[model samples]
Target chain A: MTPKRKQKLFVILGLVSLAAIAVGLTLYALRSNINLFFSPVQIAAGEAPIERQIRAGGMVKEGTVARDPDSLDVAFTVTDYVDDLEVRYSGILPDLFREGQGVVVVGQLQPDGWLKADQVLARHDENYMPPEVAQALEEAGYSPADYQAKAAEVGERLGAEAVGESGN
Target chain B: MWSFIHKLGSPRWFYAISARLMPWFWVAAALLIAVGSVWGLAFAPADYQQGNSFRIIYVHVPAAFLAQSVFVGMAVAGLVFMVWKIKVADMAAAMMAPLGAAMTFIALFSGAVWGVPTWGTWWMWDARLTSMLILLFLYLGVIALRGAFASRDSGSRAASVLAMVGVINIPIIKYSVDWWYTLHQPASFSVTSRPTMPLEMWAPLLIMVLGFYCFFIAVTLMRTRSEILRRESNKRWVRDLAVEGR
Candidate 1:
């Protein structure tokens, strides 16, 4: 109701609208350039942005990795468990890189849908629980014995799978 | 309508009310965080893939969420201050900037640390990482701008404008994982979508998020009360209260 307040309100309204316009313009201008990584399914659906530097990410399909006999060049297929993409790279892979692991590749996508990767980065699984997080779970109907048992169960399964793998 | 507005806008009135409210928020914060932390760190199953390191999400994601949310809250408060000449709102915004900046740093540090075991690196020039970094700078910029101006009124106004402008980055940071190729993973939490994770994996995270919010509220209330005392020190009531303390 006061004139002084009225003046300040007008200034705020004017500037906020100005800021909104700026954001709208930025979003509109950057529309085509905002290519986040494409998933395997997206790529298979031909939704990947073509001919530009882009990223494709998915799990490395099991047993789909092959290495050259005498070179550093390697080939692998990345899949979303539905569609698959073949990635070829000559660089030394990250230490964590392996078959059946999640990985993201940055490179060019060909018209034929092959990805020539210039770099490969393994997607790390989030795995750490701090003291507080551990404490909270304790109050949430948690039992240490049961948790350890479940972990052991998973370990046993993993060990069995590993043995089966080595036998092959 | 105006009576309620006038009462809330007064520093003295806010100080009294916030004093009453702060205790509950503090208690809730401590309890929620205590529970969230224990659950997230111990009882929650190790990630099928990342194992123990994923537990950092308990702090990392909540801090990141706070970093972005604090910035938005500051901007809204700044807007209220600028438009309505509400000193209380500006005081709240000023108190929040440092906390916001700290949360941004925590998010960045945790993200970097989380990167090593998974991405095999400590830092990347990736989009999500980069935009989040910019969010840090935006917080710092508002803080610095507020301090830069000689006149308090002008300084507050400048900070308000800067906060409004900088808020544009919040959405950019949110969508960066989806909008650009980044080493950072996409959000496990979404408002319009279901969590990609199972209930057990995400329950602790939800608690952490809520705990972080409570922590922010409690801290902001405490600090804003301090600011009120500082700014209104010359006022009769403030001086009377101070003398009464002795």
Candidate 2:
């Protein structure tokens, strides 16, 4: 290759590398802000600021949803199995919002640590299957319930261990 | 190898070869998309949760895949043009910009429509969505940069540099859902993992993706041939071909 052509190639490579590095640094600096929502664990650990609008996401705890018969008000406990955050909203939830499914709520964090949600969005997982296949899986006792139970059991054990360590 | 590359870089060679290849691509695209659309919309069963709205995946996924793939292809073409001084590569890249932008718009629009039913909102400034939006802007920027300069040589070089630099966004878009807590889900298809979707559902999606790729190639070839003719109109071969048409 001619020296001039080789030099032009090197310049192009250098420019692309410089641009990549710049973008990588920018994304790294904004990593926390780039996340769509904080997890229930992060909120529980007080990483989420109070009195400011923010988003928190986690699985909807099974059997924790309460709905008002006369109003659109609803309350649910969002849990990551390690921690739980209570979310109160007064609007219609998405069609996919249900027990054992992932959800994200946007609202202000009250002084008491509850999320007073103005918006609730359901987070779909990567799994896609036909209705009949899903029904078959449920009938075969291969349901998300088993996974939820295992996660809850692990959470309970971790809590118990923490308590024991505190007693010492 | 050098001679082969030089031959490949020739506009006349590409114009001749693509004329023969274009018909095959057009036919394949038409047949695959026709069969895939029918199978996806009519034959595939509704999702357990999403129901009928899930059928939009047949369109949305293929557009999104092409959107990203076209950007990468454009960047690669830009690199070839810059390194080898291939006018054919630059011409192809120029033709690809609008199509890439169109694909990105289609993906964003279809995704927003799908989001209304499933996520309860039409838009959110999530990582994946935001990065894809940036990709659309990058495509526009490349197109605009190409035409802004007075000299065609400088314009092509400027556009090539921009395309190469903007390609950093492609990986960010692909990995956004996995890296951050976005409302967008991760991809169902993976090279190494077991398929999340059943054959009845994913088969049509695969066909649609292949159809979209063929369509991209066919359209780019058609457009690039016109670009060659317009740019090389003063050359003897082009004038001869023009006269031969008469």
Candidate 3:
């Protein structure tokens, strides 16, 4: 190749590397802010601001969901296994909202340490199987409860890793 | 090898070759998409949880895949144009920009529709979604930059630089769910691991993804041919072709 063309290629390479470095640094600096929601552990560790609107996400703990028969009020404890955060909502829950499911609640933290949620969103996992397959698995003793437990375990591990990385 | 590269860089050679290849791509795209849509929407069983709304994956996933792939393809084309001074590559990049933008829009729109039923919200400022949105803007920026400059050569250079620089967002988009606590789920398909989805569930999605890729190639080739004709109208071969058509 000619020196001119080689120099042009080098210039392009240099510019791209410079841009990559710039973006990498920017993303690193904004790492905490880039997280969509605080895990129960993060909130418990006081990483989340008090009385400020924020989102907390984790698995809905088994046997922790309570609903009011006469009102739209509901209360549940979201857990990452290491910690738990109680969330209270007064609106219609999503169709997928149930025990042992992952959920993200958006609201402000009260002085009493509970989340008064204005909105609750269900977060689905990557698993996608037909009803028949899921039923077959369930019949084979791999019950939905077991699946939920496994999901909770994964969430707990991910949560712990997130806290560890961001705590620095 | 140098001669082969020069031939490949020639607009006339690309026009001739793509003319022969376009029909095959069009047929593949049509047949694949048609069969995949029917299979995904009608044959595949409903999800145990999301139910019928999960069928949207046939459209959403393919579109999202194409959206990212098209950006990467455009950037590669830009790099070729910049390094080799290949007018064909620049023309192809120019042709690809609008289609890439369209694909990104389709992905975002279909995702929003899917999110409403599954996530209980249409939009969120999550890492994956946010990075995907930036990708759409980057596509628009490249197109706009190309058209803004008075000189076509300058415009092409600017667009190439912008496309190359914008490529950093692609990896971030791919790993956003893993890197951050995003509402978006992690990718189901990965080269390194077994897919979480069953074969019955993912087969149609795979077909749809292939169909989208064929469609992209067919459309880009078609548009690039027109671009070549428009830019090379004064050339003898083009004039002869026009005369022969008459």
Candidate 4:
């Protein structure tokens, strides 16, 4: 082989080995952070820092829904049966949020145990639920529809206009 | 350990080991992914809330997990190249760029599928999605930079620098919500909390995660081996190894 060819080969091999080591190390080091989206039950338990912005997800509790008369602020409860959390958000609530449906809120935990939501998200369709929330419900022996169907009347009142607008 | 380290530093040794290991990883990854996906998608109970759409998690979470992991992998390769001056590391880094980018694409695509049902919109400038998009760009940058240079050595070095810089940004990306009033939600899972998923649900997830890792290892090794063979084709050992078999 020519000397130039040997040198080129050497350089290529060196780069390949370096890339492998990088990947191996990265997988090992950030395993914890990468797994952060898996389980919602842990987030609600305050296993993650309360001060850190985090997601709380579950079905909106049947009768715990509340709203502020004057502001975009709305408050509701999310439950995984054994554990329940109150989530308060001041925003244009997503069209899908209502009694019994699945929801995920991102916010900080206030001292009073309420989740002060910076954002609220509702599940998109009749058949789809947020993966995390659905997982939580299945584990809790609850179903999203069981809670969702009961609140249909109220959900319709809140969601009707928004749903129509989105259809356009 | 020192001797072992020396052996590992040898490109031929690394290539041979990775080559032998690739088949096992491919088989294991294929089996596990098949089983886990079938169980999660077909056998798992429909979500009480979501019914069937929640099935998207079967693909979304695993892809996102792989996407994040690839960047870290690329960065570590950069570190080795920087310190040890290993050319193989650069090749590995370059190979990872395409695979990582593919994973990121899957994650974004699956996330959108999942999002359409949950978020009431297909896209959001939210933290998680945006960070993921940034990660995609980083992968593209690495790949592009590697090809930009006239010298392979210079190209690898430039790509390594980019990978290292991107690694530093991971934390900032993860914490973007806390640092700013971004629309993205905070994390849902944590190290401290008891996993909220039932054994039925989480069991498959664990399988899928392991399978994804195995798949990554297999593909990377395959790519790396091709790289090694291509680079070392002129060597006497590589030539003799091939000729002797003939």
Can you give the TM-score per candidate against the true fold?
0.77, 0.94, 0.95, 0.64
Under CAPRI classification, how is model 3 graded? high
Residues B107-205 of candidate 4: C-alpha lDDT, one tens digit per residue: 889877767665756676655677789899999999999899999889998888788767755665656544432333444333455544456766777
Please report how far candidate 4 places residue A160 from its true position, in Å. 35
The numbered model that scores best in DockQ is: 3
Q: Which CAPRI level is candidate 1? A: incorrect
RMSD of each: 10.2, 3.5, 2.1, 12.8
Judging by DockQ, tell me the better candidate of 2 and 4.
2
Model 2 CA lDDT for position B114: 97
Model 3 residue B182 CA deviation in Å: 0.5
lDDT by residue for model 3 over A48-118, one digit each (tens)?
Answer: 89888999988899899999999999999998887899999999999989988888999999888899999
The digit string of per-residue lDDT tens for model 1 on B64-105 reads 999999999999999888877889999999999999999999
TM-score of chain B of 2: 0.97
What DockQ does every candidate get?
0.20, 0.77, 0.82, 0.10
Task: Tell me the tens digit of each residue's lDDT in model 4 across A3-66.
Answer: 7656755675575558657765874686445432212344444455666677665667889888
Ranking by DockQ: 3, 2, 1, 4
| lDDT at residue A90 of model 4 (Cα atoms) | 84
Model 2 agreement with the true structure over A26-87: per-residue lDDT tens digits: 99999989999987767766678998999988789989999999999999999979899999
For model 3, what is the error of residue B136's alpha carbon versus the real structure, in angstroms, after optimal superposition?
0.7
